[model samples]
Target: MTETAHPAVSAEQAGIEQALTDQVVASFDGTPDPRLRQLMQALTRHLHAFIREVRLTEEEWNTAIEFLTAAGHITDDRRQEFILLSDVLGASMQTIAVNNEAVPGAERAATEATVFGPFFVDDAPEIPIGGDIAGGAHGQPCWVEGTVTDTRGNPIPGARIEVWEADDEGFYDVQYTDGRVAGRAHLYSDEEGRYAFWGLTPTPYPIPHDGPVGKMLAATNRSPVRASHLHFMVTAPGLRTLVTHIFVQGDPQIEIGDSVFGVKDSLIKDFDVQHAGTPTPDGRALGGDWARTRFDIVLAPAGA
Candidate 1:
């Protein structure tokens, strides 16, 4: 049997496509900011290349526009669908990696950084050292203790530490409608660079899946479940701000894969189980068992 011959693309058609990409890229030449010009031109080139490489159909383009529109429509102060989209796409983690590359041969290695998920709030309630960040969120109580130090081992007293996590039900307080602020707080380190708090033990939870990003994940056969972990953002004067998470050691999802690609082996820590009737660190009475984990954070110099 003879194979049927396919029509070849005319030279003019190929030239037209290349010319369009060139024109779009050149349009950014007059941008006032040099960095903006570079970024726009590069973006245009890559975006056009993708469209051409995929031979994208008009219908598919329309569907993409609609998806982005829906994402914007669902976004609000409490819900950041754009960031969610970035996270699921691995762009968030990639950006973090690019910006937080480790310095070679440094005396002390700073803690690694990771994706900052969408649930963080700027005005998290202030908690005293060793205070409760659970804020009525439901979960097994956990004692989280840590120290903040410079890469050289100098303690960074008064470093601001923000902590947040989802409750056992796999939902943040912001996911609720009653204006709750549970499972999140900020506290300052003590003179010894030590900080501690009562928080919910981290548990594996699915990222919110009721929006456009979720639909995209479903269509792509991707899981939206993140590994169990607690978020931390530490900041101090003259030090690089660190945004990272301490994952639960042996979390099955680590091997399975974190949807946001936020897991780092160095950040995983043991969440030790305390049996029922175990003594509480601050002598708080609890009817059942709890957990404890320690994470010592090292920050790099801002100029590093």
Candidate 2:
């Protein structure tokens, strides 16, 4: 018995794919930035390869274009449908990974980075240390305390800590039709590099699904839920700013996988559920059972 050999490509189709890829890449030569030109050329090659590999049809291409157009139309100041699109597709996470990677022989560990979701508002209300940032949102009250330290363990004073999260109901302040802002604030570290504030326990929440990203999720049979976590954007004058979240260690959504692919094991922390009688670090009494979390951030030197 003998096996048949595959046929060679016809002369007409030979090099056609390469020629198209080359032509598209060549068009990027005029890009002013050398890095931009390189990226455009590489992207062109990969994009063309995907089209060819999928044997994409004209109708399918049109549908994709229409989907993107819808995403753009639905985007606005409050709603960032494009970032949501990138998040759900894991592009945002991939870009974060590439840009925030640690060096192989770095002296110390730097806080891991993650996606910055669309809910963040500019100039979130600044609160005093130990003050509540939740603004009486609907959720169990909890204390968030942490220190900002350099790679060598020295405390960094006056580090800006920008925090935000969804309430227990999985709705952020922006989602409220009443135009109220809650569950977000900015605070500064004290002389000891320590910061503490009252915030609601993080709860699993679904990304905005009323837009095109929602349609995409439905079409692909994917959930629009992100894991329970609190977002933080920490920055110090001489250190690299760290944008990340502290995920609930045992949240079921962690196993289910985050819709935005933002969870990292290093960022997972125990949200210690406590009874009402328990005393908080600030000598405050809880109205009921609530959660508590401690996260110490380590920042790398700028340009490191």
For model 1, residues 115-198, the per-residue Cα lDDT tens digits are 999999998999999899998999999999989998889999999999999999999998999999899999999999999999
Best by TM-score: 1
Judge candidate 2 at residue 281 and give its lDDT: 84
Cα-based TM-score, every candidate: 0.95, 0.94
User: Largest lDDT belongs to which candidate?
Assistant: 1
In each prediction, how many residue pairs overlap at the backbone (N, C-alpha, C within less than 3 A)?
Answer: 0, 0
**What tens digits encode model 2's per-residue C-alpha lDDT throughout 1-304?**
1112113545445367667777888899899999999888888877887776666789999999998999999888788999999999999999988888684555568989999999999888999999988987888888889899988889999999999999889998988889888999999999999999999888898999998899989989999999998999999998988999999888999999899999999999988999888887888876789778899999987877
Tell me the TM-score of model 1: 0.95
- C-alpha lDDT values of all predictions: 0.91, 0.88
**Clashes by residue pair, model 1:** none
